[model samples]
Target: MRDLFEDTATAFALKTDSELERAYFLFKLIGNEPLVRIGTAVTNFAIKANLPVERLIRATVFDHFCGGTNEEECLVVADRMFEKGVYTILDYSVEGQQVENQLDYTFEKTLKTLDFVKEKDAIPFAVFKPTGFGRFKLYQKITEGEQLTFLEEEEWQRVVNRFDKVCKKAHDLDVSLLIDAEESYMQDAADKLVEMMMRKYNKKKAIVFNTLQTYRWDRLDYLKKLHEDAKREHFHIGMKVVRGAYMEKENDRAEEHGYPSPICPSKKATDENFNQVVTYMLDNLDLMSLFAGTHNENSSYLLMEQMQAKSIAKNDPRVWFGQLYGMSDHISYNLSDRGYNVAKYLPFGPVKDVMPYLIRRAEENTSVAGQTSRELTLLKKERKRRRI
Candidate 1:
């Protein structure tokens, strides 16, 4: 069988020799766990000490991972991706925001991106974290089923209002909106709010998407229940299936709280559950839309094969393959070249604000088994092909 993702030349065709070399070095650096830890700590210290490290960071990791610092800057990357037959999901990657004003700013920024994408075919979806629009503590409180004070009740209403406005805008513009999942503590409120939005905006088609992290042992069951609910209620289900981030945090929290861990006991189990959910969603394509948001080559190939067996169209609007903007160009570009619907989660924000996201990416690449090694191997293949 011809491997769909074997075209390293097409994957790296847009990269200059210097860019390719930089990526090679970056992945190599990330693959070294000790170096990554030391570098991350040093970078944090430098930033806190007000040292001049932003330029170096931007020139390397930031430039590779993020679209740019703002929407206007993101257009350059979006245009390039569109030219290559891949779509963009403009994600405002700012994190750890707590103030009401900050949350309001994040909400307006998301609406702005939604409006921006309405005029641009290059950008297919808009995404925002639930934490971006409300305080994490508020979500945790709601998840715990705690009673809210008068002021907290007012605050909760504000969060709901923000969600409604964003979902309504996406509905009006006919653009898909992805609500990102957070940690387990904060995810219940996010799931409830996202479901409410789905019920309202997904009446005719999937205008709202809720992310499902399949690494959790219960998520597959949750998906089954959500599917049943969608069928009974006569609405569409839009989901971005991922193997979940926050495994360490989720497990740590569970242990601290004297609860059994919600995460899968083994990576093999997580992979199985992830693929099973993918199969279930594809089997019910009429009632659901799916975005297979993964960097795993085997999972991507499985989805392709399943689509073939089911005779799904390559450009089906209800199905998409997604990866982070810079981490998996091999999957994104090669899949796009093969006429599959593909999108990159192009995150953008001011450098400082998006550092947490960048650090997480770096850590994830380092910690996820074989992720950095795979990237490095592909880069080397491409470089060798180019004889650079």
Candidate 2:
């Protein structure tokens, strides 16, 4: 069979010649580890020094990767993707805010995104990190079983209230919400809260989705356990599965804390476990909804093949494919063209506030074997085809 991933024309159709060249240049830059390290250091220094670097960053990586700096600005990008049969999931990408006011601002921003998606069928989901709504220390404390003082107890209650408010809004609007997975230390708290939301709002359908990072060795068993609970409680389970980010941080923290790593021992192990979970979810499709959030071509193809074998409808509401915006256009567009439900995780925020997200993207592309090279090859092919 011909490879759907090789369709450069469909993948790059939204790109102009200059955008294609910029993408090519950016991937080439990321492929060099030393250059990326130096560049990241210099960029951080420039930002801290209050230098005028936003324009330079905006003209290059920011434009290629992010939707815009705010919700209204993202509509154009969402419309463009909708025209191509792909949907959007507007994600507010700000991070590391700790003050109460900042946390409240993050919660309000998320509500705004949810409100924006309420009437926009092209935007199927809204997502936020749990840490965005509360202090990371609070989650870690709760996870570690640290007793909270009177003040701390009140703060934790506020965190719960914020989550309930957002999830209630999502349920009322009939818009799905995705709660992102964070690091292991704080993840148990997040998972518990997300499960609570799932039980409350997902009783009828998967209005609230919890993300599962399959790179963790324990996630498969966790999924099985969650499924059992869902069946007993009579609520549908909604999940987005990815191979996982934060692998280096997870391993480093494990070593520092003198704990066995939660991650899979090898890449092959992670891949096999991801596929196994995908198969398991498909087998129980009647009780769950799944979104395969991956950039890996093989994983995408595997999900498609399984769907076909199970005779699932091409646009099944319970099965969807997702990739981050500005990456894996080949998979997103091709799958949508082939009538699969597909969406891009379109992140938006002020440039400075979103730098952490951008930095992680750069690091991910640099570290993932063959990722940048593949992107470079596809951009080059398209540029050559257009004779640009």
Candidate 3:
């Protein structure tokens, strides 16, 4: 295996001590159980102090992982990543709200996000969750297998119109858009929507990408099936593979509902399935474009090995590597250094609004073994280098 420090050292060689300290602070904070448990309390206090939470967010997690709160704000970070030979994927992380005004606001934010990135060559993709700007109850209805009444169906058509506008804007300006994968219960609706959009927009080139969660055993096969469907439908298939984020919830619901859990039996099983899907997608590069989104060292290197084994170019246009903006610099920067297409999944939104995303990251580190420790080690080494 390659030395972990080598890629990181080269990538952040210009970072100052203050930057290193900040990175370390987030690393340790996210890893600490006690600190993260009291996060709401901390956020509440920060809000009460009338602190510029957005600025604090910008300086810390946002600075590390996302582009900005909006498209215009993203340019600074996007340009910087461009300088490092990395690309940016703009994610408008506005979710879990219920207000017509908020929902309309989300649609506007999404449109603005698309308009901003269309001109940037380095930003090859844009992503958003339908839940970000839509009703969760409606999504829940769709998830529970509820048939929409005619008016509800009309509202669904409006949702389609919204997508048409977004995809059309992206298509007119020549940018690819990705629909994120959500909870398993709701994923069917998301998948169907993306497939419909892909059929509508991915004729000449893939303008719509669907996220596939391989942690669910069904999705590896689903990738092949999606490709088959793409073939029959006569449009390109764009897919992003993640190990999945909602394992506990999926399992809990499975038990609560008396259904088989969809998660792979173990982490190894998930990794194996994920790598297999990567290989399958890469082998058929003519028909599909893929994003290998993971922070796992083995999974990332496995793709590199597969590319070499398959004689694909080191920087194949059909494949790219991705990790969340703040949490996986080691993976993102290293892949960029090695002449691979690498992009950080940079999410942007107001601090209070984006707390769910932030909290999930913190919880993920604590739950996933060695994630926080690996990050902390890198931050400390970089800090030590700065001190010297």
In model 3, the runs with Cα more than 4 Å from the true position are 44-62
Clashing pairs in 1: none
Error of 1 at 226 (Å): 1.5
For every candidate, C-alpha RMSD to the true structure in Å: 1.0, 1.0, 2.3
Local accuracy by lDDT, each model:
0.93, 0.92, 0.79
Q: What's model 2's TM-score?
A: 0.99
Backbone collisions counted per model? 0, 0, 2
Query: Per-residue lDDT of 117-195 in model 1, one digit per residue for the tens?
Result: 9999999899999999999999999999999999999999999999999999999999999888989887998899999
Candidate 2 backbone clash number = 0
Model 2, position 210: C-alpha lDDT score: 94
- What order do candidates take by lDDT, descending? 1, 2, 3
Q: Write the per-residue lDDT of candidate 3 for residues 1-388, one digit (tens) a residue.
A: 4564246676565356777778788878788888878975777578668876767666777666555666777778778778878888888786786766776777777787777677788788888887765666676788789989998887777677777788888788778787788888877776787888888888887778888888999997888788898788888888988899888999999999998999999999998899899989888888888988998988887888888989999788778888887667777777787788988877887766676777687778888989899888878777676668
In candidate 1, where is summed lDDT lowest over 10 consecutive residues?
Answer: 1-10
- Superior by lDDT: candidate 2 or candidate 3: 2
Model 2 agreement with the true structure over 237-267: per-residue lDDT tens digits: 9999999998999999999999999899999
